[model samples]
Target: MCNNISFLGPKGTFTHEAAYILEGNLIPYCTIPAVMESVSNGECQFGVVPIENSIEGPVGLTLDSLAHKFDLKIFKEMVIPINQNLIVNPKTVMNDITDVYSHSQAIAQCQEFIRDNEIQPHYAVSTASAAKSILGDKTKAAIGNSKAAEIYGLEILKPNIQDLDNNETRFVVLSKNDHEPTGRDKTSIIFSIYEDKPGMLYKILGVFEKESINLTKIESRPSKKGLGKYLFFVDFYGHRKDKTVQNILNELDGLTYFLKVLGSYPEF
Candidate 1:
């Protein structure tokens, strides 16, 4: 029940669209760090940040920030379906465009279209920023959501330009307030093994198997301490407070360099 929420944006970014449910004061931040920091420092009651994508994988900054920067907890999650469109000025045509602008990730999502059109890709801070920058320019275009087109008074030259038909991003709601256990919930955690012994990862995962916990996702990110040192981020179907999950976590503490429970949130 947050009264205000912050998201990565200047508006029209997918994160902005995903945050509509809060129905609160919407604050747009420039970067993921700024969004998380806003909630950590009490500038806002909640912050919405993208954590993973169906095609491109985990958002690195969000993972690193959750693992290292803030002690915030995830309150909820939602999957945002991405429909990247080719947006242009009303006077522009496909062949008339000289350059296309968008966030790097958006450009990648629309690679097939960009390659086919032969337009140079310019990176922008956000999809909405790209749309805003292309105003009054017949030679420029942007790749972003339809909202960006509406916000910037542009037109959708092509719709659903993403490489895949069902492209989507998973976003998490971050807050200083801890969430109570919902009957259907998932727990996220990050752990690092002190030793690089063989089967260490398998052994860690074994705890989940022993306790009958169903793991939905597992990914390794750099530990940032040194090369080849990594921390494993695991998501599974159950709250941290559940008896089985607590038992597994208690056992994991002894086998890990450190075990940090990122949060327990209701599944999207």
Candidate 2:
């Protein structure tokens, strides 16, 4: 029914952790697009996928899929602390580990440790999947959270191996509808310009400035239509239904080549 929620999985992935923010029968998918596709095709009522990581910037696949492939709304956001650990078979030790496996992002986050230990890096679809792969194999270790170690019956060879101590990831819940406006809310939108010009973008920002809306984030992604053409994604502190936000969007709609209100959800 509508209670089924999909997440990037084999369970124990960060997205899996974020999916717990909502109550549902959590279903696991192999990829972010798969999770989104499940929701788009009505196989699941909601899906949770990571939007960005503190250490490595945004998850481009999730943003690109949301911009192009899926017509989904972000229902909510959940932020989770990430502590990358070196997980190994119970019998394996640091010296026995010759190769490491994990999602590219995880590998990137723990590059320092990998380099210091002289372990060859291999990529897996997800950190949980990496943990699954190294089962019964002593030479290979996986970099992931502690939950993955527990789920895969592995041992934590080293804890908090990520380069940074304050690692976190922001995940979004995708569904057909956005959350109802809470007084404290945030709106995300994507837009493109008619032509590349200096003042054009400046004028768009001016609208928010004039309305006194606090802009939280602004990022650009290639529109993929042509060179120099890009899509601008903006997150601001207000609900789409709020009068001031509506004013800013109305003005933006008229100014840009096209504008899409991504969604409005309670600020996390």
Among all candidates shown, the one with the greatest lDDT: 2
TM-score of 1: 0.97
Candidate 1 accuracy as lDDT: 0.90
**What does candidate 2's lDDT look like per residue over 1-268, in tens digits?**
5889999998999888788878989999988899999999999999999998887988889989998888999989888999999999998889999999999999999999999999999999899999999999999999998889999899998999999987999899999999998899999998998885668999999999999998888988888998888898899999999999989988998999978887999989
Candidate 2 local distance difference test against the native: 0.91
State every prediction's TM-score relative to the real structure: 0.97, 0.97
The Cα local distance difference test for each model comes to 0.90, 0.91
lDDT of 1 by residue, 1-268 (tens): 4477999998999998999877789999999999999998888999999999988889999999888888988888899899999999996778899999999999989888888878899999899999999999999999999989999899998899888877999999999865789899999899998765777888888898888899989999999899989989999999888898889989999889978898899988
RMSD of each: 1.2, 1.2
CA-RMSD of model 2: 1.2
Backbone atom clashes (below 3 Å) for every candidate: 0, 0
